[model samples]
Target: MSTVLEILHIARFGLAGVFLLGGGFFVLAGAIGVLRLPDFYTRLHAAGVTDTMGSTLILLGLMLIAGFTLLSVKLALVGLFLFLTSPTATHAVANAAHKAKLKPLLGTYRQTRKGDNEGGSQ
Candidate 1:
């Protein structure tokens, strides 16, 4: 019985480690996406998907490792807060970008001619 309990504990620890690593990778991917994406909307998608999920997963894993203590409860609460706010925040940002008339990157290759005076008076 004691051996079984120990094995279970070790397994939980391993699982938590895996979650942490995975979450970290997701965060890194989000950062890369923000850097590499062509436009604001796509970057918002990357950040919203990756940041929220990574934060939630990491918090959940930490809670499991914490084993029902106050810290675990706090971590769970933090995760809940993040789950609630991340998408809302992302949407707000995207909406603001849209309202500000930021253009999405499309496959249009219209090159400005010399003296075209784009974004200026004719």
Candidate 2:
């Protein structure tokens, strides 16, 4: 009985650690996307999607660690709130930007070398 309970404890912690690590990865990737993406809409999408997912994973980890407690309940509620709000906020901002005439970059761009136009007439 003792060994079984001990294993359960270790498993819970291991699962929590995995959730936390995954959350951290998503958050980091979101930050990178916000920095590296070309346009406002794309950046907003990256931030919005990752924010909800990352926060949910982190809160789930916290809930796992909290285990059948009020803290876990609170974390769940917070997660729900963020899950509902983040995308709504993102959409609202995107809509506003669109209404204000913010345009996204479209089409392909290729940089040609100065001497690379050999196929055409000089």
Candidate 3:
């Protein structure tokens, strides 16, 4: 019985480690996407996706490590909130950008300078 409990503990720790690593990778990808994507919309998408997923994974790992405490429940709630909000926020931003006439990067507009928010032409 003790051995079984030990194995379960080890399995939980290993799973948590994997979740953390995956979350870290998502964060790194988001950073790279911000640096490399052609335009604002794409970059926002990358950020939104990464933020939601990375936070969810991280919170899940933390919850696992936290066991059945109040802190664990709080972390789970936070994760749920993050999952709900990130994409909605992203979409709102994208819609605003569209209404504001921000143009996508294609062909001639391949690369715009950072901090340029002219919103293309009317």
Candidate 4:
């Protein structure tokens, strides 16, 4: 019985640690993407992806660490709140930016004057 309990304890901690580490990596990648990418929409993408996934995983790991207690319940409630709020907040920000005339990275460029002569002199 004692051995079984010990194994469960170890498994819980190990799994929780893994989840936390994974969540941390997601956050780090999001941060890097935000920094490397230009423009408001792209940065918003990075922040949204990280905020949703990273927080979910981190909160799940924390719930596991907390086990069956009030703290776990609180964590779950927090997770639910975030799940409901993150995407809405992201959409709100993005919509506001759009209304303010922000544009996404469209990967299109205007032809230079030097190249104008190539197409029969515009």
Candidate 5:
């Protein structure tokens, strides 16, 4: 292949790698959020938003690698399906929780660093 074509190919793969890494990061962050968050609602919010975004980015990376092929078309369809369904599912769950009288924690949450505490400096 020509130098320009080779460069283009390298650029495509590089971009795909970036997208895949970004998707992985978002998914990892979402997992951490779910584990660390204080309440069901907050955890749900983290999971819902990041799950959709993360999957979309990952699928996009896969599509880029697949190029103009049947596999890419299928991936696009799957992405569309998830993009539509995930938010709907999240909303449904939230609504059910609300109907069941599950309330989110309200008010302020304060966390002090190691050196700072009730003693005021150390």
Candidate 6:
């Protein structure tokens, strides 16, 4: 019984560590995306991804490390708030952009087949 308790504690710690590390990587990737992406829309998309996944993972890690306590409860509340706000904020920004008449970047298309070129514009 004692050994089982000890193992459970160890497992909890390990899981908590994994969650924290994974969250950290997500945050790192998001940061890179923000820095490297071009245009306002793309940058905002990167930022939104960062805001959503990054905060969620970090908060989840904090909750795991906290265990069953007031701290964990508080973290849960904060996580809920982040989940609700992130998307709303992103949508609000997008709406603002639309109102401003900003055009999104368009991608160029090409045909793979030689025969398809005849059907397309010369």
- By the TM-score metric, which is better: model 1 or model 6? 1
Report the lDDT tens digits of candidate 4 across residue range 33-73.
88976556778989976888899889989999999999999
lDDT of 1 by residue, 20-67 (tens): 888888888888888886556677878865767689778878887899
User: For residues 1-122, what per-residue lDDT tens digits would candidate 3 score against the true structure?
Assistant: 99999999999999999998889888888889988876787799789657777887888888888999999989988887877888788889889988887787554443455434543534
* Candidate with better TM-score, 5 vs 6: 5
- The best-first sequence of candidates by TM-score reads 5, 2, 3, 1, 4, 6
* Candidate 6 TM-score to native: 0.81
Q: Give the TM-scores of the predictions, in the order they appear.
A: 0.84, 0.85, 0.84, 0.83, 0.86, 0.81
The list of candidate 2 runs beyond 4 A from truth reads 109-122
Runs of candidate 4 with Cα error greater than 4 angstroms are 108-122
Prediction-by-prediction clash tally: 0, 0, 0, 0, 0, 0
Looking at model 4, report the run of 10 residues with the lowest lDDT sum.
Answer: 113-122
lDDT of 2 by residue, 1-122 (tens): 99999999999999999999999889988989999876676789789647677898888898999999899888888888888888888889889888877766554313222333432222
- Candidate 6 lDDT, tens digit per residue, 85-115? 8889888988888777766544532332334
Which portions of model 5 miss their true places by more than 4 Å?
110-122
lDDT of 4 at 45: 89
Q: After superposition, how far is residue 66 of candidate 5 from its true place, in Å?
A: 0.5
Q: What is candidate 3's local distance difference test score?
A: 0.80
Q: TM-score of model 5 relative to the true fold? A: 0.86
* Cα lDDT computed for each candidate against the true fold: 0.76, 0.80, 0.80, 0.81, 0.82, 0.76
